[model samples]
Target: MSPRQYEDDDAESLPDSRFLLPQLRDADTEDVEKYQRGGLHPVHLGDIYDGRYRVVHKLGAGGFSTVWLARDDTEHRWVALKIVVADYSTSVSTKSQLSCHAASRCASDAVFGFVLERRHFTLDGPNGRYLCLVLPVLGPSASDLSKGIYSRITPSLSRRASYQATRSLADLHAQGLCHGDVTTANILFGLLNIDRYTESDVYRLFGAPETAPLETESGETPGPEAPKYIVKSLNFLSSIESVISQDVRLIDFHQSFLISLPPEQMLGTPAEFLAPEVAVGLKASPASDVWALRCSIFRVRSGEGPFSGFEVTSPVDLLRIVIQTLGEMPSSWGDTLFDYYGQPTKEPTKGSPLEPVVETGRVRLEDRVWKEDKKKPYPPCLSDTIRKPTATKINNSYIDGYSYETDELLEALPKISENEAALLYDLLSKIFVYDAQKRPSAREVLSHPWFHMGEL
Candidate 1:
């Protein structure tokens, strides 16, 4: 059997198989096991798999696998690795007894499926059912940007990020593989090399072992982030930052559907992004990816997604939402969508936070005083609203965070508008047209007005 791949959330996991897999029964046993597991290969800096690939950090965790960043033995490069496990997390002993076997197999199939396609997904290996991907140690994702953690992720940045994602998707469709599932969780935005900052400025692995819960005797978190091991991003260095206008790379292919038809047709993605056809048994086509991509980009621009905070107790219920809203492609889906064309489109008279923040598991930001000197206040580029435990460090602690400082990602804070947002999405919407024949190819997307300054 292969190792289980962790789902970011229950909804991210498929209903048919995920629910069966229970959480780990005990945290204490799991904690002890992390030490006893032996494969970790600990180092003074941290743990490792082999002497060559030093496991400096982790990016995130899942039910069956834990991801990490290891230095390449030969090249001395940073890469991401997904460690396979025997079963679901220790929390679910009461759930699917078959979860372990099924998860392992599915994980293996997923890695192999995408690697063969040259699309983004888990990295593949020859043994232990773990899929370790060597990703470009780029900067933080837009979520990092939006949190006002780094360079403010404004509407323009969000729109541009969406454009890049679509451009990449267009390229993927050209390659005959379809990204079945698309979301902030699945997509990673690379920070252009902003030389103004250094490694100390960004967050390391937020969920890495180095940041293990201090209070938990078992040494693991109550829910996910257990077996903690994913690289965390820092939140400074981007104060004057701009969006990367250069080549933007997309990521996460674990749920990517490869056939000509998008995977949504078979088993759709989380209800939030699922298209109308996908909610039914209809397979998603390039157009399906287009719809989800638009929703994602729009969400980034507005600081919320189409189904940002909605919760559904049953699959049947989610299906209903998918059919009703997705089928309609209502403008309502983009709630906070404001346009900042040269002129600001009229604000929604209804009203909302100027830039509301989501993901409320937040720690407030405070001033940093490194080296025990109050004189060394936090950098001006960094907002006072930074996450607490401020003056974040790569110290041997359990929590790690970093911000993006890549030059490629810096976007000038231009006065952007609803017309522009609509125009941008409408242009990109070509990717979601129900008919694949109607979809614009990558070559075509690049030539569109969004990229071409027709009116500026």
Candidate 2:
């Protein structure tokens, strides 16, 4: 089989795949073996890869990949290098799509109102050979922005961020692409230069890594490496402090889907942003991206998403939250109950979380009720207010510990002009509608009154 064909099954075997810290490399034979098993490369403070980029410091790590800030010695610029298992790397078809997307636009474009630059190639890491992608170095993510300095994005900043995100999505949609994951973490601020702030200041402000050495059994200790360059002037941080109007870009397209591909092949998104159609087994589409966009914009404007207060322990709980937040499943979804080949459905697993969901098929429990979706199979006569559940034991595992007063989306939304508020509500409602067909396209969303309100 091709490398891409074996990726899904093999991803688990290489679970802890990340670049090994310099301290762990010579510790012992066991440490070496562990690094090999986890597919961690022997990357250290000063290693150069592909005869060009020099490792600077770690950016961050995920289960399947590790990103590092590297200086391109050839180009004399800072860039992000993301290393992943060869099997889990982007496929030929995906590369084609990314290339097509790249050729269709300039390196920096007015349409997107943001930068989206990337370059990918294969590299031989210490544990095993891997695939690496080289990308432009950018600043803190939108989630970082929200949780950091401002506590929450101001109303004006939120408007600009949402507009950029929607316009970016519209550009991708025009090419028939769906960015599978569209959350705050995937949105990043544009930075002019990494040299603008001192290393200590950058570490304090953005939490960039400063090396920490590990103790060795042999007692041959090496000191932490100092950064190659440091800035003497620190005026840039203050100058750019009020620049919330700067560009924001959507990123992390590893899970992105091509609309032309078979529905079964598309991967699911982060649970919190998963659309109703996706949870129920329908293929993800551009409309599903619209759903995620709405959720992201909501979190940006308000401090939480509509269903933010729910404690979702699994995919099933996510579905319950969807049903509770939005009304009952669409009437059109009834046709999706059949088997994949259009055959009759089999009986659902008994006592499963799905059991309660499917059994309560068309019933609309009171809109926006707390702890309502978990009740067991209901009786013919049921009172909405009663705490006692009938024969069914309500799954209280999804309890959200958040008090009502602390929910920013419900309580702390920034006050805005009535005209802007009305336009925002109408735009969000159109995308949040339960039926995927009824949801507006990304282009349609970009044209909404809220986006055009400045013109009026």
What's the lDDT for all of these models?
Answer: 0.42, 0.56
Question: Each model's number of backbone clashes?
Answer: 70, 0
Q: For residues 124-226, could you state the per-residue lDDT of candidate 2 as single tens digits?
A: 6445567777877765566654521123555566777788888888777776667777888788766655645454544554444444343333544422221
Cα-based lDDT at residue 308, candidate 1: 50
Q: State the displacement of the C-alpha of residue 133, model 2, in Å, after optimal TM-score superposition.
A: 1.0
Per-residue lDDT of candidate 1, residues 1-456 (tens digit)? 111222244346533321111132211112222322322211223554544556654454443445555566666545555444433222122212222222234333232212121112222222222333344554445454443322235444454565667666665665556666676555555544533333333233122233332233434442322233222322223334442432334555545554543432244366667654454334576666776776676556544465553453223334334434435333433332222211112355423212322322222223222223222333443332222222233233312122333212223223356667667667745654444467655446666665444311
TM-score per candidate = 0.52, 0.67
Give the runs in model 2 whose Cα sits over 4 Å from its true position: 1-42, 90-118, 147-150, 195-208, 211-245, 262-266, 331-419, 452-456
